[model samples]
Target chain A: MIEVFFQYDFLRYSLFTGVLIGILAPLTGVFIVVRRLSLLADALSHITLTGIAFSLLLGRYINFFAVLNPVYMGMIFAATGSLLIERLRHTYRFYRELAIPIILSSGIGIGVVFISLADGFTTDLFSYLFGSIAAISSTDFTVVLVLTTVVVAIFGLFYKELFFLSFDEEQAVISGIPRRSLHFLFILITAVVIGISMQIVGILLVSALMTLPVAAAMRLAASFKQMFFYSVVIGEVSVLAGIFAAFHLDVAPGGMIVVVNVLILLIVLAATSEKILNRKGG
Target chain B: MKNSAAPYVLEVKNVSFSYGKQMVLEDINMQVREGSFLGLVGPNGSGKSTFMKLLLGLLKADKGNIELFGSPVQSFRDWSRIGFVSQKANSFNSGFPATVFEVVAMGLYGKIGLFRFLKKEHKKKIKEAIAQVGMEQYMHKNIGRLSGGQQQRVFIARALVSEPELLILDEPTVGVDADSVRNFYDMLKELNDKKNITLILVTHDIGAMSEYVTDVACLNKCLHFHGDKNDFEVNREEMMTAMYGHKVNVIEHNHSHDHHDHSHDHDDLDGVRS
Candidate 1:
């Protein structure tokens, strides 16, 4: 197993993918939390899963777009999913949250139908579902690398505008911040992050990677910058540990990674609640 | 509806706006000069905010041309000369991760413009604006940690950060305690009187606005009555009747946090748009 880790180029790709996702997830997560759209991430992620299943079925059954990559198809589908959800919410003139359940059910229903029709999957399905440390291509590595770089750069450059829009959108619009353009940009960025996340975390649990560390970070940090800092620090730690454990245990890296993140969240909540109670008691 | 001859900083001449078929504002003609404080006063849903929106280009007037500075979109593309604070000032994601410095820095985003970031001079302006609002001590503090009045100062600093000639505030004092509201008005008056920065504060707090404003404009579906606050001292009944559409007994709620929840005309901004 150790030899496999060192010997395979795929293993190297997997390691790089893990590290990239580790940092990127929580960076975007802070924005989601700040904007109060944490659950929206979960809904979009499930939409990605449905897209992947649909693409795989199309490639296998219909033989249409036979040469196209299923992962790429999934990315496009998920982005469209996010966009459609946004559009429907606007058209309905109600809370955007109303679209969440409808989209979520559609994703799950389509995923179930595809899973049943595909004659079931094996460890290869595990590769797509829970992630594989042994199935990455150089191409996949490059994709993940580009995604990480672009996400980081976009967030850094637009930090002020996004902050302004998130905190006081009316103020941003009133001060002539080109808020409608920024609003579209923000949703597009979220779709991009979710699109890229499907490569490693997969649709099954991408939002966990995106949301868990931020939830933990929110425990102690009062300010947005501090919350972002703590979320990234915690995310990096979880990914490193998840990768290490996956390396030793011979289990699926994706499930292990999310489980590790959940454990960290629980621990953070426990620790925070105690401190809050103590502060009150004192 | 465009009053081209009037050399006012803002003009909404005979304008009207509506959502679907329901008219929100009707035949609203108003103007403000560059260096004068303009108080926007009305009951809730009386089209005060809608009028502000027409001027800010947030919502377009259905029937008239709204002008700002020289033109609407022209100055909209360049709003460094204007500052604004909405009623829901700091009620955003309270658990957000930014400090006070970052929040104030966003005021200069228009000055910074698209495809660029804040420069050294921008940072200096942010610091100076914070100090001017007496929030220099809280510059490094998280925006959520401050009290309501302090948060308001940060917002005002954000407005002042860009050194705008015109500053417009919408219902900035509701949901706040008495002393904080007083402090907010004091700061606003000081800005107008001392710095010569023009202000347009929209609120139901009539007495405070009447005391501080150089000019007053009451909005219902139309421009009711506008002149100096002394117009209120002389013609209060007429203005109130025009605003309410009937004779309203001007009693205890005259100078208080009168939350007019039954108002159906204006849109609610309680939720953060994300």
Candidate 2:
């Protein structure tokens, strides 16, 4: 792997982006899982797909868009989708989850229209849908790196506030944690995470990379910090293993990564099943 | 109520709030003095929790003004001076993966502000808050692993960690056992008496409210009665009548009547009230 990275810049970019996405995805996923907003990630991922599809369509005709990175457009759409989700959730307060499906459907609707208008399927669209090792560029690596840094920095700044909000939103509000702004920031960050991660993990499987490790971690972790650490570790391992497997097995890295995460989840469930069952029985 | 040179910790003047077309709170007037334990009692859907939310600025009042520590609620940025334990604190996210200490430390987050970190003094305050709630033994314990009452205490500790001058709790002991409920009130009393912390407790347990609180406020979408506990006792029937919008028998139960097998006692109380 070291020799391959040294020999091929594409491999280096691919692996680098993979590892960072691994860390950032599950770190934010801890909050998503805890908040029961895992569906929001799925919605945001679909929105990113729509953005990619639209950018692709524009690139086919427009000189400026042809040179621009599609990920930037993906991020803008994802962020807009996040704000819309927040708005819809607030508007339909009782049916908060309603935002997810509405956004997801709209994303697919727009994406399908854009793909059709662009005169059909392309290799780039396929890579964005399922992620390809050969598709990652140095620019994609930089974007992922910057996004990961932002996520880490946000957490560092608002760790306690986020924890309180996630743990007990009522208390967080009463404690005056600026619930509205903080929550908005959180969803925006979630959008950005999905946008950056979709290059390696792909739009369809990106939510899995965000959620699966945290889901596995939640079963055994004793505290919030422990859950976060375990999720990051699990994510890192899954990403590395998936990348290696994809290299050897000649498969899409996104699908391979998600498969690795599912395997890890199953193993964790198997190992902790007895204790969980006993707990329930007792 | 102990005068104790205590100023008004909270003041609500003609406050009214509504959700959509439904009037949740109507023309409410209340003032909580410093070093006072006030029990706010009402039936389900009586807006007890909504009233707390208004005071805590969680819900904006449709009309009227609220002041915390002499500052208008809209301008009251010093949240550390006011602690709130919401009604759903017990039932919210029971499986939340946080330790007792971590949960308590969250109380200081607003005061600690953004971009800064918890200091040594903040850690000490967190520990002290946990110890105050008698949850020191479970400082490192996962909040989800604790019993309902234990989790409630952790929430109280979280509120206390901020060292607020006034603490507001909305139904803090909903599912707690008799013993734990008793202990919970005793802890609140201790905080009020020893620390001069003004307390506004919203509870359905009128019996506990009458016993532990220095003052009583009867509410039902409106302020029916607000006075000392003795005065509330003197006008008990009238207060209950105003609260239920019908005549109700006031049961004469002893202070120590709360027990684990409270079903029978509750039946009798219900029989009298109904």
Candidate 3:
């Protein structure tokens, strides 16, 4: 595996991008899960898919559009979708979750139209949906690195405020944290993460990367800080193992990574359930 | 200045609030003197919660001036001087992953400022706040693992960790048991009397709070009464009528035995809102 990675630049790019996505996803996922916006990730990723499809459609006509990376367009659409979600949530305050399904459906509806307009699934669309280990280039790796750095920097700068907001939003507001802008910034960050992660995890499986590791970590974590640490560890391990397995098996890394995460979640649940059963029996 | 009389810690004047079309609070006016334990009692939907939110600047009043420490609430930027224990303090997500110490330390976040790390002094303050709430033994435990009452106490510790001059609690003992409620009031009393922290405790049970508070205010869409407990006791009949918007007969029981009776009265009065 080490020899293969050194021999092929694409393999190196895939491994590097996978590791970055692993840390970035769960790091942002902790806040997403705690804030109960886990489904918003799903919504945003689907919107990102629409953006990718639109970019692909444009690529077929205009040479200038073809030169532009689809990831940039995906990010723009994801951010716009995130802002729209926030706006709709505020508009229908009584039914906040209504925003999720509306955006998700719109994304899928628009995505299908674009796909059909482009005359069926191209290799690009398939790779965006399931992620292709072979398609990862050095440019994709750099893009992933930049996105990861931005996410980490934002988390570092706003750690306390973010923690307070996620734990209790009302309290955070009462404490005089600027609620609207911070919330919008959070949504924007979530959008960028889903957008950049499409090359490795793909749009469909992106939310799985964001949530599954945190789900497993929640069972054992004693504190928010510990939850974050455990989630990152779980995420990194799953990504590394999945990428290695995919390399050997010649499969898509996105599906394999999510499978590893599911396995980890099952193992944690099984272990915790036995302890709970024993305690009850005793 | 000195001759003009001391400034109040909080003053709400001509406050009127509405949710969409239905009015929640109308012409509400109240004041809290410095270092006084003011108990705000009212039935559910009587706008006690809404009033608290307005005072905390969480909600803007449609018409009114809320002055905190002599500054208009709109200009009151010194939030660290005020601590708020929200109505859902005990009802927060049970799966929220945080230790007692971490929750308590959150209170100091506002005071610690942005882009700054918590120092040893902040840690010491958190420990002291937890100790003050008598939750030192459980400081390391996950907050969710504790009982509802314990969680409430941790939230109180979180509020106190900021060492605010004014502490406001909005129906803080809602889900707590009778004994825990009694102890909770006792802790608030201690914070008021010993630490000289001004307290505004909003609860449904006027009787439970009547024994500990220095002042009492009854509310039902308006401030029916706001005065010293002695005056409140003198005009209890008139106050009760005004508070409920209907005549309510009362028998004055001895002060020492009011706790048990108050808890019983609250249960029967569960749905009694004007």
Candidate 4:
């Protein structure tokens, strides 16, 4: 397996990209889960799919777009969709969660229109939807690396502020944590993470990578810091194992990674339940 | 020990606020002096929350001027100087994955500013704040595992961690048990008397409020009364009846009285009917 990775540039690129996504996804996902915005990741990923479909459609007609990477287009749409969701949330302050479904539906609606306009699904579209080891180009690896660096740096700088904000937003605002700008930056980062993660985990399963490990970690970890650390560890293990299994079994790395995440979650739940039962018995 | 430059920790002059077509607070002029504990009492929808929001700059006053530490509320950038513990603090999500130390450490985030990490001194301050609230035993404990009263104490510790000159608490004792409520007020009184930290507490517990607070203010969409605790006590029944828009009973209890007997009475203003 080690020699196989060394021999094939494509496999090495997928491995590198997978490792970066593994770290970035769950790192952002911890905040998302705590804030009760797990579904927001799903909404943003669907919007990214719209961007990918639009780019693919444009590529069919325009020579310039033919060589353009769809990930950039996807990022732009996801970021815009995030801002739109924020705007809608403010517009309907009482029913803030409604913004997710509205944006999510619009994303899928527009995405389908673009997909149909591009003359149905192709092998390229399938890879983008479900992710493929062969689909991760050298350029894709470089983009993921840069995104991972930026996301990690942002988290490092604003870790405390973000934690306070996530724990109790009203208090964070009173303490003058620049609530508006910080929240805007947070949602924008979430959108971008979802946008980039699609290349490794695919659009449908992108949110799984972001949320599943965090869910599992939440059960086992006592503190937010512990939850954060555990989430990243679980994410890395799942991604690395998924990539290796995908190489041997010839399946979508996204499916394998998500399955591993679910498996871990089930194991944690079973172990914690037994502990609860033992405590009750005692 | 008072800062002569800013004698008043908080000043609200003719501050009026309203939502769409409905007034929440009107012409509310109040001043909180340095080292004084002021209890703000009002009914459920009497604009206590709105007034706190205005003071904290969460909501802009529709009509008047508000100041914090002698600076205009709008332009006030030194937020760490004023600590706030909201009503929502008592009702936080129990599933939130943070230890008491981590939650209290958040108080220093604003003071420490961006792109910086918590140092040894900050950690020392966090532990001291936790100790101040007598939550030292639960420093590493998950906050959700604690009882309601314990959680409330941890929140106070979170607010105190910044060592603010003025601490504002909005209904900090809600959901706290009767005995713990008394102890909670004692801790707050200690913070005010020992540390000389100016305090503003919003509560329905008029009985407890009168016992601990140096000053009192009554509000019901308007500033009904703001004076010394003695004056509030003298006019307690009349003022509360007028403010609540119904007959209100004032069952005064001494500091050494058994709290369990009258705990339900002091929990809510409406609980003591007739």
Candidate 5:
């Protein structure tokens, strides 16, 4: 099993891609969960699916589309969807969460239409939806690598500002934090993360990979920094274990990774609950 | 450029604000002198929050000029010099996974500027601010697990971390208990007196605040009364009746005799209907 990784380029590519996504997803996930925008990740992932499906559909007729990676289209569609969500949130104002459902439904609706136009779900679509170990190519690895570098750099530069904005938006705005541009950049980055992560985790389960580790970490960690640290640790563990198990079991890595995350969350919840009960008893 | 020698820290001249056709504040003129603790008291929907927003540059005044530190608010960029703790500070999501230390550290983000990490001096400042708020023991505790009063104190610590020249608090004692409210006010008074940080506290509890505030400004779509606390105390009944459009009772708690016992003066003006 260990020799298989060195022998097979696909296995090595998928493993490296998983490692990068594991770091990026949870890093951004901390902010998303804290801001109570967990559902926004799910909506954006669905929107990325629209891009993926559109690319697949276009490949049938357009020679250029056949060579182009669907993940790029997914990223483009996801970015557009994120901007629309921001615009709609302002439009509704009072019903801000309305933006999530509207975008979510439109994404899935448009995605289904595109999938149908592409003559229904093929094996390639299946791999993209559930994630396959063999499907990750060198090109996919390069995309993830570049995106990881850009996202990490942005997070590093604006870490404090982002933390302040997430905690209290009104106060951040009052303190001259450029709330509009920061928020715009935040959601745009979130969209790109969701789009790129779909290669290993699939669009359906991408949000889970982003959110579950944060949820589990929040239960155990005392501070935002601790939660961030713990979330990345949990994300890395789940992705590595899930990928390894998937290769051995010949199953979808996305499902295995989400299951591992769920297991970790349950364990953390149980442990924390017992601690709380003991504190009350003593 | 900060006019450190300027007599007034804030000046609002003929400021009028409206939301669409409805007027919230009308031609409000007020000045907060340097080193004075001004308590802005008003009934609900009396535009106290809106006034604070205008001062913080969150909202633009429709009809007048507002200045902070001798500079027009439109061009005044020294935000770190003015710290603000909003009314919603206590009402924040308790489930947020940040410690008291992490929460207080965020107050320096603006001052620290972009792309900069917290240095040793910044960390020392954060700890000192937490100590100043008397939250050192709970420095590592999750902010959500703390009591409303403790959380409010942490927010005040956050505001103080930047060492601002002016600190503005809006209804900071809304959900705080009677005892904690007294301590909160005492802390604000200490900040004003000892640190000489000019304070602007917007609250409904003008009765409790009268002990600490150097000046009082009663508002009801307009500045009904703005004067020294002594004048406010002398004409408390008449001024409150005129501002609230009804008879009101002003309970002045004597701090010298029973500083600890605040059960009688627990509620704000709304609680004291008579």
Candidate 6:
């Protein structure tokens, strides 16, 4: 495990990607969980699957869009998927769940079609799914870096507005927080986050990477600010530790990361939490 | 200043509002002095909450004008002078980790604005407001840990911390026990007397709130009547019945029930507005 750190540049890139994904996923996930948009994350990630498949198929055919590598192509497609989810969700107020199914099922259907069109299993697609640090290239690394910086900046600028909207939207609007602009900006930020997370966590469990830390953090933190702080810390730990363990075992880092987070959650729940607290609940 | 010396802090002139196509408030007009406790009473759907919203600029009226602190229609930019506490506003999850100070500090979001953080004076004011609400002991406690009444007190403290000229309360007594309602009113009366803050309280607790309020305003969809408590108490039934388009003999009941269950949606009050 220790030798893996310096032996391969892939390991270095993977660790770097894992750390960034760990921070960005849960930061955005805190917004998702608090706003009751957890399902939206899943819906968006499934759409990324379709993007990955398209990138692969196009790489074989037209090749230019894929010239940038499959991951960037997939990211661009997933961002579009994120935007579509927001539009559909907004249009269908009462039946917002309709948007989820449309994006999710269509994404899966596209995945199947593209995989068949490519004929042979691409090494990149498998790595993209279960996650492989071996595939992280300089170009893909650059995109991930830019995406992280943008996501972090957006989150910081719109932090208060987003918090208010999640907690008390009407109050936020009444206070002249420029809610409509903030809402769109928030969705745009989510797309960027989902795009960056695609490499490490894959199209499959990217949403899980976003949500599990927040879910775990909610048990311990007392305020929105504290929740964000702890959720990020928890996410970083799980990803770094899980990726290190996966390196030693030659297993899928995505599954390891999710499992580590779940295990950490259980330990935290056991250590600090009292189920009986609800009895004296306010 | 004499009895008439104080300037009008809030003036609602012939305001009317409709939800979709249904009219809620029709031709409502009222004036509040700089320092006064005004009680709003109606069976339900008396447009009391609607009026408060109109006053707070939360909702726009179909017709009429609202003036705050002698401002012309366009002059009242942000209503920092007006503090508000609505029933739905208390729906924050109890498990929320914010301490009473952090929760109360949110009220200053408008006053403090972005870029600049809260200053020392703001902290002092927050402490003073928390002290005023008698929750200083629980200042560090997570807001979710507090009881319903205490939670409401925290909200009141939040509003008070802003040093609003006109403090608006919309059914703040909801979910609170009967014992707490009196204490809440007493606390309010003290704030009104001590701080000299103008209070406009919309409530169903006519008996208790009425005792503390200097004046009363009754509504159903439009203004029914509003005047000094002495005038209201003297004429009670006759005055209220006459003001409503339909005759109503409201029976005062103990308003100590599951106030936490208070819905923001105004229930349909059958009585007609004057």
Compare the candidates by DockQ and give the number of the best one.
Answer: 1
Best by TM-score: 5
Runs of candidate 1 with Cα error greater than 4 angstroms are A1-4, A58-69, A274-282, B1-7, B73-75, B245-256, B260-274
Q: Each prediction's Cα lDDT score?
A: 0.75, 0.83, 0.84, 0.85, 0.86, 0.77
Docking class of 3: acceptable
Candidate 3 vs candidate 4: the lDDT winner is 4
Per-residue accuracy of model 6 over B204-247 as CA lDDT, tens digit each:
66777766888898888867777777878888878667655566
Superposed model 2: Cα runs more than 4 Å off: B245-274
Across residues B37-139, which tens digit of lDDT does each residue of candidate 3 receive?
Answer: 8888876667777787778776678998999999998778899999999877766787788999999988988888778888898899999999999999999
| Model 1, residue B193: C-alpha shift (Å) | 2.1
How do the residues A1-282 of candidate 1 rate in per-residue lDDT, one tens digit apiece?
Answer: 446555778777877777787888888888787778887887877777777777777767676645555667766766777777877777665566888888888988888798668767655556666666765678877887887788788888788788777787677766656666666666766776776665666667778888889888988686667888888888888776777688788776667778888898898888889866864674
Query: Can you write out model 5's per-residue Cα lDDT over A1-282, one digit (the tens) per residue?
Result: 767876889889988888898999999999999888999999999999899999989999999999888888999999999999988987877688999999999999999999999999888888788887776789878878998999999998998899988888777777777777888899999998987788888888999998999999988888888888999999999999999998898889999999999999999998899867865675
lDDT per residue for candidate 5 within B184-234, as digits (tens), equals 899998998889899999877777888889889998899988868888889
Give residue B136's error in model 3 in angstroms.
Answer: 1.0
Q: What is the lDDT of residue B212 in candidate 4?
A: 87
Looking at candidate 3 chain B, the ten consecutive residues that score lowest on lDDT are B265-274
Residue-wise C-alpha lDDT for candidate 4, range B1-274, written one tens digit per residue: 2234538888899988877788878898988899988888876677777777778776678898998888998898898888889777866788788999999999999899988999999999999999999999999998988898999989888888998999999888777778998898898999998999999998766887677888889988899999788887788788888887778654553333322222112111111010
TM-score of chain A of each: 0.88, 0.97, 0.95, 0.96, 0.96, 0.93
Clashes by residue pair, model 3: none
Give the per-residue lDDT of model 6 (tens digit) for A63-85: 58557566655666667877787
For every candidate, give the share of true A-B contacts it also has. Answer: 0.55, 0.69, 0.60, 0.71, 0.74, 0.24
User: What DockQ does each candidate score versus the true complex, computed on alpha carbons?
Assistant: 0.44, 0.41, 0.41, 0.43, 0.43, 0.28
Error of 1 at A120 (Å): 2.7
Model 4 pairs whose backbones collide: none
DockQ agreement of candidate 2 with the native complex: 0.41
Candidate 5 positional error at A185, Å: 1.1
lDDT of 3 at A274: 79
Candidate 2 yields a Cα-based lDDT of: 0.83
Ranking by lDDT: 5, 4, 3, 2, 6, 1
